[model samples]
Target: MLAPFLIMLREGLEAALIVGIIASYLRQTGRQAWLPAIWVGVFLAIALSLFAGAGLQMASAQFPQKAQELFEAVIALVAVAVLVGMVFWMRRAARSIRAELHASVDAALHGGAATWGLIGMVFLAVAREGLESVFFLLAIFQQSQDGAAPIGAALGVLVAIGAGWGIYAGALRLDLKRFFRWTGIFILFVAAGLFASAIKALHEAGLWNALLDPVYDLSGVLPESSPLGTVLGGLLGYRDAPSLGEFLGWAGFLAVTLPLFLRPSAPMTQAVGQK
Candidate 1:
């Protein structure tokens, strides 16, 4: 549930920021008439995301048990890859996103049939974010069958919407750099857990048996089904008793990725709508 909550929060905040920025830019430029087109694009993108998620879930349900496990493992790996790419991309691109969006908006406004052009631009942008959210949510849902996860995701989105509104309204000032930096680290750890879980699932599917040795058994102390254990398992991919392969996969990913993610770098300029 924690994993789903954070995933939804990050993805939702990103989409909300994009939409808010577009709306703000249009209003400031006296292009308020274009707002409807952006809404249309956002709604359409959301619909497509939902459709895709449902389709994937239904397809997975029909598979045999072992096949389903394998599929889940594959999805987890894909989610980890996507999450890693997104965290780095967001950090690197934050400084220039506003300018990029404004440039695109300016071109679309000047283009012939501006409404369709604007709609296409927003649709593609929001849809990309939406699709990524759908994949991540699906992966977490497969791993943790906790009933509260969907509610957590919904709450995260609602909070993100409020945050975006406050920021756009000039009533709130977020330290976006710090927020993103910490969340990126949190996501890196979660992705590492996913990587480890994926390996475990593959073994469960009767595919990988090379590292069947038990690393250590903590199930005797804090079983995964215990209250705290469940939360930890759902959020951090905590395994009470992990095999050698799972331990190695988890540790190896964090050892390599965490340092690179936390490395100090030059400060970035704030993203502005125009010069």
Candidate 2:
């Protein structure tokens, strides 16, 4: 539940921030006429995301156990890739995102068929985030048995929407850099867990045979079904009797990605996601 909540929170907040930035830019530059089109793009993007998620879920349900495992592995791997890429991309783009966005808006409004161009821009931006969330949520749902995960995710989106509204209205002041930095670290851990889970899934699907032996058995002390174990499993991809491949995948991912993420970068010249 907590895992999905955080995942959605981060993803939803990113979309919200993008929308907020675009909306704020429009208002400042007397392009408020395009505001309604922005909302239209957001709605369409959301509908598409929901449709894609539902289609994938329903389609996966019909697969055989082995096929299902393979599918789950594929989705987990894709989620891990998207999550990692998003973190690094945002890290590198945060400093110039506003300026880039402003430039994009200018380009969109000046292009032929300006309304469609702006809507297309907004749609693409929000859809990227929405689709990313959908994949991440699907991976979470596949691993979880509890209903609270969905509820937590829904709540996270609501909170993120509220925050976005507040920020756009000038009623909220958030340090987006700090927020994303901590959440990016949390997300990397989640991705590492997913990578481990993907390895386990591949083994289950009869794809990978090596590293089948358990590295250690913690089931006697901390069964994966236990409440704490479930939380850890859902959030950090914990397993009681994890295989060598799983352990190595998890540790190796963190080992390589963490330092790269934490490395210092260029200084920001302006406040992020602020009007």
Candidate 3:
């Protein structure tokens, strides 16, 4: 439950931030006429995401046990790929996102593109984020054994929406750089866990075998059935006696990914006297 909550919260907040930035830019530049198109895009993206999640869920339900495991493995892998891509994409785009949006808007309006184009731009932007969230949520839901996960996810998203609104309305001030920095680090750990979970899924599917036996059994000391253990397992990919494959997958993923993500990008240098 906590895992789903945190993942959705982070992802939802990102989508909210993007929407807020675009909306605020339009208002500041007297392009408020296009605001309706933005909302239309957002709604459409959400609908598409819901449809995708439902479709995947229905399809998975028809599979046999091994097939279901395979499907889960595939989904988890997809989610990890999307999450990694998002982290890098946002990092690279952080400095130029505002300028890019402004340029795209100007081009659309000047090119005599219909409002549909404006709507499409917003739709695609938000939909990318929405679809990614859908995939992550689906992956998490597949692993969840309890009923609390869905409720927690819903609450997280609701909170994120409120936060987004507050930021956009000037009622809240978010340190976005700091927020992403901490969340990005935390997400690396989450991704590592997901990777390990994916390996477990593949093994269940009979696709891979643990080359090494369980490293050690800690379930007696830290039972996953316990609330604290469950939280740790969900959030940090904790396992009592993890197989060699799980350990290697988790460690390798974090070791390779975290360093690159942590490296600072070149500073944005604005022209002097420009606001």
Error of 2 at 46 (Å): 0.7
Candidate 1 lDDT over 1-275, as tens digits, reads 67678778888888888888888999998989889999999999999999999999999999999999999999999899989998998888887899999999999989998999999989998898888888788888888767888998998888888988887777888888888888898888888888988998899899999887888899989988788887887666788898899989998998998888888766766678885
| TM-score for each predicted model, relative to the true structure | 0.94, 0.95, 0.94
Error of 3 at 43 (Å): 0.7
- Model 2, position 83: C-alpha lDDT score: 98
Model 3: ten consecutive residues of lowest lDDT? 105-114
* TM-score attained by model 3: 0.94
Which residue pairs show backbone clashes in model 1? Answer: none
TM-score of 2: 0.95
CA RMSD for every model?
Answer: 3.3, 3.9, 2.5
- What is the C-alpha lDDT profile of model 2 across 204-227, one tens digit per residue? 999999987899999999998889
Q: Global lDDT of each model?
A: 0.87, 0.91, 0.85
Off by over 4 Å in 3: 268-275
